[model samples]
Target: MIKKLFLLVILCSLQVAVAQELSCTVIVNSDQVNQTNKQIFKTLEKSLNDYVNQTKWTNRTFSVKERIECSMMITINKYENSAFSGTIQVQSNRPVFNSTYQSPVFNYQDKRFTFNYVEFAPLYFNPNVFESNLTSVITYYVYIILGIDADTFVKEGGTPYFKQAQNIVNLSQGSGYAGWQQTDGNRTRWELVDNLLSNTFKEYRLALYNYHRLGLDNLVDNASLAKQSIAGSMKLFDKLNNVRPNSFVLQAFFDAKSEEIANVFSDGPKVDIVKLKETLNEIAPLYSDTWSRIKY
Candidate 1:
């Protein structure tokens, strides 16, 4: 019995060590870069995939089925020497309760994402320290994605994770990276995390929890109430837009959700969508084209 218990402990330890949080697909696009050596991009893609997938990002041990689904597409606009200039579009989603359908949670592009890379240099994540711009950017988004996912499950559950990303932002400041400083563009990473954790944007975070946990997760039980909850969640933003006036966080929210919102209300059991549409147009006028798809 003693030997059997020892073997069981060894197996459990291996499983805990091997479990990873993110099942992220990393893509490197070099079409814009004029380089005959395409092998470097492929190598970089493989390296990034390995780095992101194999890393133990959190203290929580997640089963393989519980891993977060996300993707990162890096478009290399220019590559010269060992320096690479590009944009990274990061997106993530979560599974709905009692359903096979996955709900889209985050979708945003970092236009000022430029980073240096030496081919085959092993990537490491030191949360307390500032490393390469490439790793800092990637790690920042990983925490953001994790934070967003956590927010959907519990009220303000993502606070700790958002704080972690904030720490990364704090550490990376003045690293000569464009997206790391307050002076960087409004849509930069610094603004993204800062807005998320700010009380000024608290509605955005509440809406996230309501839309997912109370709305999508309960759709199978009572879609009418669920749709109403989702609409009520959007209504949380009515006064917010007036204050911030088309803020970066608001834009990012609509960017990821406009289509999904339209689809949810369009096909579901009718729920006073006329008022919902009005609210959507007022807050997210940029996605009015998508909002129009939601029938009265």
Candidate 2:
């Protein structure tokens, strides 16, 4: 009996340790990027927070009330055409507890059980170079990394939010520089941004379809389907790249999604289900991708 008691204590202590080890935050390195390009950083930051606040899946409900610490590290790459880009790092200390519970057996056999570990998925995003293309790049990363339900929100009349995001891109128009509406002659740079956004919407739809067809959550599972989906997206990316490969923001936007498409299958293309799992990763969470950028 004493041995069982000791085992229980050990298990409890282990749980505490595991919980303590799970810490997450977002870091941005803005070393060389300046105040004039601050809008890009702001847009990225908003998308990151929106992702955590809105994403649902995981079979575990995070404490929305609990404050999760996040930061950003921004740096200017002088060699890359004085390009401005940022990386978003997310760490979570709070244990994303599994809702599944095992019955407490006090006298059955004095048995001890090992703690089960849950896997966490990482975030990904590429920085945009051009101010005009920044909006599309930022928005794409938010959807891919943060898992925003862009289609549902947009279809639900989230016009105000979409327009606000558009405004961010439009701000850089004219004055001898490319704007959202301005034509760069044969360059078709603006057209590329528009195409990028259009392609992103398609990918979102594909993600939704895969989520529904295969009962999985996070990119850790069902990577093959993600690959196939991304492969299709690449066709679009290539077409757009041909138009304005020079646009850093545009190039990064497609590159980031391409990476995500590859990682979504990082855990392999299979989800666990003995018999009763939702047809489409039932725990799939819904997040409003445009809340930060849109007014409505």
Candidate that scores best on lDDT: 1
In angstroms, how far off is 52's CA in candidate 1?
A: 1.1
User: Which stretches of model 2 miss by more than 4 angstroms?
Assistant: 1-73, 77-160, 175-193, 196-215, 218-254, 257-296
lDDT of 1 by residue, 76-160 (tens): 9998899999899999989999998888899999988888888888887787788888988898999999999998888888999
User: Model 1: runs farther than 4 Å from truth?
Assistant: 1-17
TM-score of 1: 0.93
What is the C-alpha local distance difference test score of candidate 1? 0.89
lDDT of 2: 0.32
- Give per-residue CA lDDT, model 2, range 168-229, as digits (tens): 44553442333344355432334433543554344433433333233122223544563454
Best by TM-score: 1
TM-score of each: 0.93, 0.31
